[model samples]
Target: MPRSIWKGAISFGLVTIPVKLYSATEEKDIAFRQVHASDGGRIKYRRVCEIDGEEIPFPEIAKGYELADGRMVILEKEDFDNLPLATTKAVEVVQFVAEDEVDPTYFNKTYFMQADGPGTKPYVLLRDALVKTGQCALVKVALRSREALALVRPRDGLLVMHTMLWPDELRSGEFAAPPETVSVSDAEVTMAQSFIEALSGDFKPEEYTDAYREALEEVVQSKASGVAMPEQTEAPKEAEVVDLVAALRASVEAAKKRRAEGSAAATG
Candidate 1:
C-alpha cells in the first residue's frame, strides 16, 4: 500500500472521523537532467546569504516575504506551525451542494481520504449519503503547510478530496474573447453540431497514450545504442478557412468517415 502523506480528521457536523490522505495521481513524463555537454557532469545549486555574502547552511535558511516597500519579513518554521487555524489539522466541511455546482477549472490536485481505525463506520455513512444525494462536500483543509479549499466526494468506495483554486486565483478571460461583431449563420451552427455529434462517445481514458513521450523514449534508446534515429515526418499545416460554413461541413464529413472506419475495423 502507498504511504499516507497526511493524517487528519473529517469534521462531519459534530462527529470527527480520523482519516489519512494519499495522493491520487502521478505524472509519467520523462525526466531530463541538466549536465555539462562534454563531460556529463550534473549541475548543482547552493544557498548563499546576500547580506553577509557567505554560504548558508540548510538549518539556518528561513522563508522571507518581500513587502511592497522593498523590506523583507523573515518567518521561521515555528511561525507556521503555531498559526491560529482550525483547518491546519482537520477537514472542516462547510456545506454540501450538487456536484455540478462546482466548475472543473477550480480543481487542482486530487487525494484519497481513507478512514482510520475507529472512524470507518462514520466514513461509510458519509460516503453512502453523498452517493445517494448526488452531492459533494465543500471543505477546508491544510496540506504541506498551506490551507486550501477542497471538495470531498465518494468514488469507488473511497472518499476523494480535490483541492481547489481560490476564486481570485482565476483570471478573467475577457481579453481573449472574440469581438461582438463576429457572428455565425444558422447553417454553420448546424454543421458544427453535426461535427460534435459524429465525434461524441463515452470517454475511455485508458485507450489513450502519450505519443510524444513514447517518441522521446525511442529517440533516447536510439542515441544510447548508437543507432540511426527514426526519420521525422513533416508537421501538419493549418488550413486557412476562408469559408466558415464549408470548413464546418468538411469537418462533420471527416468525423463521420473516421467513426465509420473505426466501427468497420472493430467488426472485422
Candidate 2:
C-alpha cells in the first residue's frame, strides 16, 4: 500500500472523521539523472555553507527568509506549528455547493481520504450523504506547509479531496476570447457542429495511451541495451482547405470515416 502523506480529521459540522490522505494520481514520465556526456559519470551536488565552506547535511538544513535589507530570518518546525490556523491539524468544512458550480480551473491536486481507526462509521455516513445529495463540500485544510481551499466529494464509494487555487491566482482570460468582429455564417456553425457530432463518443479514458512516453521509454531501453533507438514516424499533415465551408465539410467526412474505422475494429 502507498504511504499516506497526511493524517487529519474531516470536520463535518460537530462530527469528526479521522482520515489519512494519499495522493490519488501519479505521473509516468521517465526520469533522468544528470551525468557527464563523455563517459556517463553521474553528476553530484553538495550543500555547503557560504561562510563556513563546510558541506551541510539534509537534517541540518533550515528554511531562511531573506529580507530586502540583506538579512536572513531562520524558521524552525516549531514556528510553523504555532502559526494561527485552525486547519493545520484538521480539515474544516465551510459550506456545500453543487459540484458543477465550482470551476475546474480552481482545482489543483487531489487526494484519497481513507478512514482512520474509530472514524470508519462517520466517514461512511459523510460519503453516502454526499453521494445522495449531489453536492460537494467546500473545505479548508493545511497541507504541504500552507492552508489551502479545497473540496471534498464522494467518488466510487470513497471520500476524495481536491485542493483549489485562490480566486486571485487565476489570470484573466479575456484576451483569449474571439473578437466580436469575427462573425461566422449559420451554415458554417452547423457544419462545424456536425464534425463535432461525428467525432463524439463516450469518453473512455482507458482507451488513450501516451505514445510519446512509450517512445521515450523505448529510447531509454535501447540506450541501456546497446541497441539502435526506435525510428520516429512522420506526423500526418493536414490537407490545405482554402474555403471555410469546404474545410468544415471535409472535416465532418474525415471524422465520420475515422469513427467508422474505430467501430469496425472494436466489433471485429
Of candidate 2, the 10-residue stretch with the lowest lDDT total is 229-238
Cα lDDT tens digits for candidate 2, 126-204? 9999888999999999998888999999998899999999999999999999999999899889988998888888998
Error of 2 at 235 (Å): 3.3
lDDT of 1 by residue, 1-268 (tens): 9999999899999889999999999999999999999999999878887788898999888899999999999999888888899998899999998889999999999999999999999999999999999999999998887889999999999999999999999989999999999998898888888888989999999979999999999999999999999678999998898998899888888888988998999899
Which residue ranges in model 2 land beyond 4 Å of their true spot? 230-233
Native-referenced Cα lDDT, model 1: 0.93
